[model samples]
Target: MIRWDWIGRNLPEIRELLGDHIVMALLPILLGLLIALPLGLASVRWRRLYQPTVGIMNVVYSLPSLAVFIVLIPITGLAEQATVIVPLTFYALAVLIPSVVDGIASVPTHVRQSAVAMGFGPMRRLLQVDLPIAVPVVLAGVRVATVSSISLVSVGALVGRGGLGYLFIDGWQRQFPTPIVVGIVLILLLALAADGLLVVAQRLLTPWARARSSA
Candidate 1:
């Protein structure tokens, strides 16, 4: 039950929506990673910060996405991409903070000692030793966050900012399945493509980890 005529006519609109969807999805991921790195580092450095930080993030994560949009509208305004981006950033953080903490934690004690013995200072050790070892775990969390962000960007349609989600609303209003089906298919493909890219990145970035895991 697809309309080739409609699809052909609306190709430009569809491309615009897809571009918006990609931006809405990827921006939060980039922002979340930037924010999560510092926070994650702080949490790992100060042992007591880990639990409360994660607890707070979990609470934020549990908030309904719709509710967040409503709450944010006063500040970010209705139908603004910022409203959508802000909440998705928090959701990404929820998955990523734990991943960051656990990834760094997974670095062996002996490795840290080795770095210290080699005269690698705190920053050097973090850059050269800890983070490199943590890449696989962090990338795993990133994959989850990326997929989640892509899916959640659609919810923004309720606020008039949903990327491809607009198609769903349009289809529903007109009682047509074409736009709805197209939205779903595109979202699925986007998520898969994004996740696949992350998998490739992980392999390239952490070849040693792959060899170790296989062994």
Candidate 2:
């Protein structure tokens, strides 16, 4: 039994929590992209680095998120968003790096030969040819990472940085269900909205991939 009046009274606080949640969730994805691009490119370019790079990221990903938050609290403090953002960024890297390596690998060999024959330099070829071709695969990874990040941000509530996650804690402590239900609903909506936007982005960015698949 939800209390509608309670919800109405708490709208402002909920909005603030949602805003914080969006910031906490999104900043990691953006940061992970910036870091993963170079690491992924290096892994692909060097070949030998891919196994080890991914191995370390996998280990990092496997560590419990709650434990990581506790470990960081001493350094970043209990209330700092960095305690949450730093670990989540690493998690995003774990997923994105593989996607990037695989995406670049999916590029056909003849395409590389064609780029070389056209006298395109390494940088130009990467920007104009390789990355464009890899967008579909990379975006697929982004979609997964984005959803995972949104879901994981709730864990930060345990440390005081979780956005709507605070609602879960509040609801539990007070023996009330409304805040918990509201939190779940809002998180679900955010995840769906984010995923939908990424799908639209994939279509706009890689129209040819859709055409090829349909054919």
Top candidate, metric lDDT:
2
Q: How many backbone clashes are present in model 2? A: 0
Q: How close is candidate 2 to the true structure, as a TM-score?
A: 0.97
Segments of candidate 2 deviating more than 4 angstroms: 213-215
- Against the reference, the lDDT scores of all candidates come to 0.95, 0.96
Number of backbone-clashing residue pairs for each candidate, in the order shown: 0, 0
Per-candidate TM-scores read 0.97, 0.97
Candidate 2, residues 60-92, lDDT tens digits: the string is 999999999999999999968899999999999
Expressed as tens digits, the lDDT of each residue in 145-195 for candidate 1 is 999999999999999899999999999999999999999999999999999
